[model samples]
Target: MSEADFIARLRGIATDPAARGLADDVAVWEGLVLTHDMIVEGIHFLPDEAPQDVAWKLVAVNLSDLAAKGAAPLGVLVGYSLGDAAWDKAFADGLDTALRRFGLLLLGGDTVRVPAGAPRSFGLTAIGRAPEGGAPARSGARPGDQIWVTGTIGNAGVGLAMRLGEIEPNETCLAAYRRPQPQLTFGQAVVPHVHAMMDVSDGLLIDAQRMAEASGCRFGLMLEAVPLSAALLAVRPDVVDTRLAAATAGDDYQLLFAADPAKAPMIREIADGLDVPVTVVGHAGVGEGVVLTHKAQRVPLPERLGFMH
Candidate 1:
């Protein structure tokens, strides 16, 4: 079955309100926010990548979920697939550095040895203290709310291309592909002002469509309004195709949110105070799914929206 199909089936068993009908990135219960993410060799990361970077990616991705929910991380339980002794040690060192950097605890976990030569895989469950107002849900977006995204889109996708030697290498793109920084502080600060929020992991377009669907509204996105970094523009021309490619490229762990237009000044103020760049990419409407436009002209949806499992 497809990922959506699998989730639909599992929803029956995950009836708790915290499950968010299996429609959200994290589960919130009591006063805590919980999320789990797994990465695998050759899929989530290049096989030749360093163990340290891999470990960091594993941790950052899970925390990205908490960041979307405006949660302050508490700790993590690791699910490790044992591999070479030296590699495992390096991963542990990297994990220690990441946990220290984020002020998170290494609670406890299990380790396993997979079959010989199997791809290395790791999982992490991150627990965090929910924001005082409560964690935001993807289903909370409302019509007339403006859609905002943190940071630029498609840099990580470009980074992946750079890693594969398809494009010239640049530190900006390379680092983005290797190490994605979750917008935790921004997510937390902006939560009270946002009507809905989520981290863009799968692609901007696909994730936006999900938020729109969950919230029972339509998202009208302006292609030109989708932010592109100077580093990305240095390599590719400013064109619709480039914008579309960036919109559909996954692995951008930036926050995407919706808020009242009246909250624009406050949102901008928060972003300015944090020195983080944010852009108004779209607005919620009284329909379903996502609609795109460029230079005021309608654009058909791309056949492939983003990464799908």
Candidate 2:
């Protein structure tokens, strides 16, 4: 079954308040926020990618979910697939470094050897302490709320293209893809002001559609307002197609949130204080799904919104 279909089927068995109807990524139970993410060779990462970067990606992606819930990471449980001895050793070292960098503990986990020549895969389950007031939910968005996104969009996707030799290499894009930084601190600080929040993993457009659907609202996005970093613009032009491509590229771990229009000044202040750039890309309206506009002209939805399993 498709990812959505599988999740839909599993929802029947996950009928608990903490499950949040399986509409949100993380499960909030008691005072803990929990999330699990997996990265596979040839899919989430290139087969020839460095073991250390792969390890970092595995941990960072899971933490990104916790960050969306405005939680402070506590620890992680790693599931490893045994492969080459040297590679495994490097991955372990990388994992140790990542955990230390994030101030997280290596709780415990399992290890198993995969079949010979099988693709390597790794899984991490991250646990975090939820924010004091309660974690924000993707389904909490309401009509008239302003939509905001942390950091620039499409850098990671562009980075992937660079790795594939599809574009010229740039340090900014390369680092973004190799080591995605989750907005943990910002998420925690902005939780109280946001009506809804989620990390942009699969792609801005797809994730936005998910939030809109879960909240039973419409997202009216302005392509021109979708923030693009100077590094990205230096490589690509400032045009509708470029914006669309960025919007659809996945692997961006930045946070996308909704808040009251009146919270704009406060949001800006929080972002300024944290030294993180945030942009107002859209607004929630009384409708459903997502609508796009570029230079005040309607734009058709792209056939492939983002990566899907």
Best by lDDT: 1
lDDT of each: 0.94, 0.93
For model 1, residues 34-75, the per-residue Cα lDDT tens digits are 998889898899988888889889989999999999999999
Candidate 2 lDDT tens digits, 1-309 = 887788889998899999898878899999999998888898899998888888889999999999899999999999999999999999998898789889999999999999999999888999999999999999999999999999999999899999999999899999999999999999999999999999999999999999999999999999999999888998999999899999999899999999999999999999999999999999999999899999789999898887775
After superposition, which runs of candidate 2 have C-alpha atoms over 4 Å from their true positions? Answer: none
Q: What TM-score does prediction 1 earn?
A: 0.99
**Deviation from native of the Cα of residue 64 in model 2, angstroms:** 0.7
After TM-score superposition, the amount by which residue 234's alpha carbon in candidate 1 deviates from its true location, in angstroms, is 0.9
The total number of steric clashes, by the backbone 3 Å criterion, in model 2 comes to 0
TM-score of each: 0.99, 0.99
